[model samples]
Target: MDIEYSFNKRPTTDQIIELYDNAGLPRPTNDKERMEQMFENSNLIITAWDNELLVGVSRSITDWVWACYLSDLAVRGDYKKMGIGRKLISLTKEKVGNQSMVLLLSVPTAIEYYPKVGFKKQESSFIIEREQ
Candidate 1:
């Protein structure tokens, strides 16, 4: 299908919203606020686009010193298996550098995919709901 894409370290606001929305993943009601925090706290984020269309996204929170978390990776369903996700992961990891512990959350259906991109199981994370 001639998928044309590139990895970007700092994408525009429109690209961020578009890819995150098009990824079809369940996100929190505060996704917009959370994304703003991510951009502020994260050392780097990678956005992949197929031509001009926002198709994939992956972001990381890292210190480039000890630890990193590869969070919020998603690609459009129509763009799946096209290496867009892989490319985003690669770009994030490369930016994190070696000697950093990297991690991510994956669904049961997606567990196998991350290992191929150089991730492994480490520990479990959780969230406790608070009254809103």
Candidate 2:
């Protein structure tokens, strides 16, 4: 797999929706505007591509100094078990540097996966669920 990684390369909305669906990430793929805005507003984005296919992505909001919220991490279903997700994360951290901490709220299925890639489980976090 000759996967190439890019920082801040925005994938098309269709590509992102397809990937999120394929990866079982459970985002609002049905709402195109929301999906488009999601990526557009994100400050940091890491993408993995296999030739022309967008295979993986990591989307984050960061200040590049103190904290980075890795809002989305998705890899194509067929591309799982490869290191694409890990590499996307590694690149996200690399871009954010050591001073900023990377954080994310993992999907239930991925709760076990995060720790393997260097995310510590934080018990103090809280969230007000989105009404949508």
Candidate 3:
């Protein structure tokens, strides 16, 4: 199993949709506006490839000077724990650099994972879900 990492490279809309599908995240319809908004306008996207297969994706929306909100991070289930996810996180962290604060909202499962990458538990935050 030879795996390679490519960072800061933009993946196509179809690639994103497929990766999201494999990760069990939301899949997009044929709407161009939603398609255009993939990755949250993240100029910084990290992807991992196992040969031609997309194994991982990490997206962040950052100002490059202050704070960065890591919107989504996923790895195909078969590819999990192979360092692909860590590499994606590393690449995204490097892109954000030191000037920006990295932020994310995690489900219970991620609480252990995030702290391994230098994220601390934060209180005093609230969320209002969008109408879907």
Candidate 4:
């Protein structure tokens, strides 16, 4: 697949929602406005595209010099295991450089996948759950 990766290239809300839904990744895809805001508020967005089709995305909010919270990583179901997600993260790290570290909260299904991509399990992390 001739996939092209780009930084800060925001995919349309519909494309993002479709990808998220197709990948079975949990996100507020039902609310288009919130989805739009999610992308709009993100400072770093890495997207993988096959021609015009949005195949994968890695969205994050980062300080560029301190830490990066990678809030989402999604790829079309058909495109999974093809290294699209890995490339998106690799590109994100390259852009942020070594001064900052990438961090994320993995979904249950993806819990075993993160460590394979160089993320060490951090036992000291804590979170205040978001009310649904």
Best by lDDT: 2
Q: Compose the digit string of candidate 3's lDDT tens values, residues 3-94.
A: 77776456677777777777765535356468668665667777888787887888778898998887788889788787777777777778
Stretches of candidate 4 off by over 4 Å are none
- Which regions of candidate 3 fall more than 4 Å away from where they truly are? 26-33
- Model 4 residue-pair collision total: 0
**Which pairs of residues clash in candidate 4, taking residues 3 or more apart in a chain or in different chains?**
none
Better of 1 and 2 by TM-score: 2
Question: TM-score of the candidate numbered 1?
Answer: 0.74
- Runs in model 2 with CA error above 4 Å? none
Clashing pairs in 1: none
Compared with the true structure, model 3 gives a TM-score of 0.82
The 0-to-1 C-alpha lDDT of every candidate, in the order given, reads 0.71, 0.94, 0.76, 0.92
Please state every model's RMSD to the true fold in angstroms. 3.1, 0.7, 2.4, 0.8
Candidate 2 structure quality by residue, lDDT tens digits, 66-108: 9999999999999999999999999999999999999999999
Worst 10-residue lDDT window for candidate 2 reads: 1-10
lDDT of 3 at 114: 84
TM-score of 2: 0.98
How many residue pairs clash (N, CA or C atoms closer than 3 angstroms) in each of the candidate models, in the order given?
Answer: 0, 0, 0, 0
Which candidate gets the maximum TM-score versus the true structure?
Answer: 2
